[model samples]
Target: MIGLLSTTFGVSVASALLPLISVELFAIGLVLKEPEIPWWVLALVIATGQIGGKLLHYYAARGAIRLPRFLRREKSGKSSPGRWRAWLESFRENCRNRPVWAGSVLLISAVASLPPFAAVAVIAGWAKVPVSTFLITGFIGRFARFGVLAAAPAAMATWL
Candidate 1:
C-alpha cells in the first residue's frame, strides 16, 4: 500500500513538473513488476494522480499569465519576445475563434501523448480554454493512455 501510494504521488508530481518523462509508462512498468497487486488499480491510481498534477500545471500557467512582470517581460523583449508574443496572440486568437479546433488539438495531444501533456496543459490554460473541457478531456485521455501502457507489458509477458 505504501509503495503504491508513494509511486502514484511521485509519478503525479513528476508528470506535472517534467514534460520529457513518460510518467505513465514508468508507473505502469513499476507496477507490473509487483504482481501481488492488481495492475488495473495501480494504473487507475496513477492516472488520477497524473490528472491532478496536470491540473496544477494548468492553473500555474493561468496564474503566470496574470502576473504583471510576465506581461512586462513579454512586452520588453525585442526579437524573441516579438516572436513569442505573435505566436501567443495567434494561439489565443485561434482558441477564441475556433474553439472546437483548439479543443480538439488539446484532446488529441492528451490522448496521443504527442507534444507532451504538460505543454498542452500550459497552452490550454494560457489559451483560456474551459476548465471543465480541459479536465474532462485530460482525464479521459490520460486514463486511456495509462491503461494502454499498463496493459501492453502484461500482454507481451503472456505472449512471451
Candidate 2:
C-alpha cells in the first residue's frame, strides 16, 4: 500500500511536470497487475495526486506572467517584451473571449490523452481561468480517466 501510494504520487507529479509521459498508461499497467490496493482507492489516490500536481503547474504558469520581463515594455520600461509575451497575451485574450470553449478544452485535455494535460493546465493558468474551476473540472476529468484506465484491463481480461 505504501509503495502504491508513493508510485501514484510520483507518477502524477511526473505526468504533470512532463507532458510526454502518460499517467493513464502507468495506472493501466498497475491495474492490469491487480496489486493489493483496491482499484477504486487507487484511482482516487491517483486522481488526487494528479490534481495536486496540475495545480502546481497552473500556479507556476500564473506566477510566471508577473515577472518584470513579461510586462509590457511601455508600462514597465525595464525590459522589452518579446514574442513569448505577445503570444501569451494573444492566447489569454482568445481564452477570455471564449471562456466556455477554453474551459471545455481544458476539461477534455484532462480526460483524454490528446492535447496534453500539462500544456492545457499551463495555458489555462496563463489565460487566467479561475483556480476553482480548474480544480473541480480537473478532478472530475482525472477521476473518470483513471477509472476507465483501471477498468479496461479487467474488461480485457474477461474477454480473453
Q: Could you tell me every candidate's TM-score relative to the true structure?
A: 0.78, 0.75
Candidate 1, superposed: residue stretches over 4 Å from native: 20-22, 64-81
lDDT tens digits, residue span 108-127, model 1? 87778687777888888878
Cα RMSD for predicted model 1: 3.4
The RMSD (Cα, Å) of candidate 2 is 4.5
User: Which 10 consecutive positions of candidate 2 have the poorest summed lDDT?
Assistant: 65-74
Worst 10 residues of 1 by lDDT: 70-79
Model 1 quality (TM-score): 0.78
Query: Which pairs clash in model 1?
Result: none
Q: Quote the lDDT for 147 in model 1.
A: 69
The lDDT of each candidate is 0.74, 0.78
1-160 per-residue lDDT for model 2 (tens digits): 6887788878877887776777777887787675556767777888888888888778877875353565333456647789988887887887888877777787798899468787888778868888887898888888888877777777777799
lDDT of 2 at 46: 83
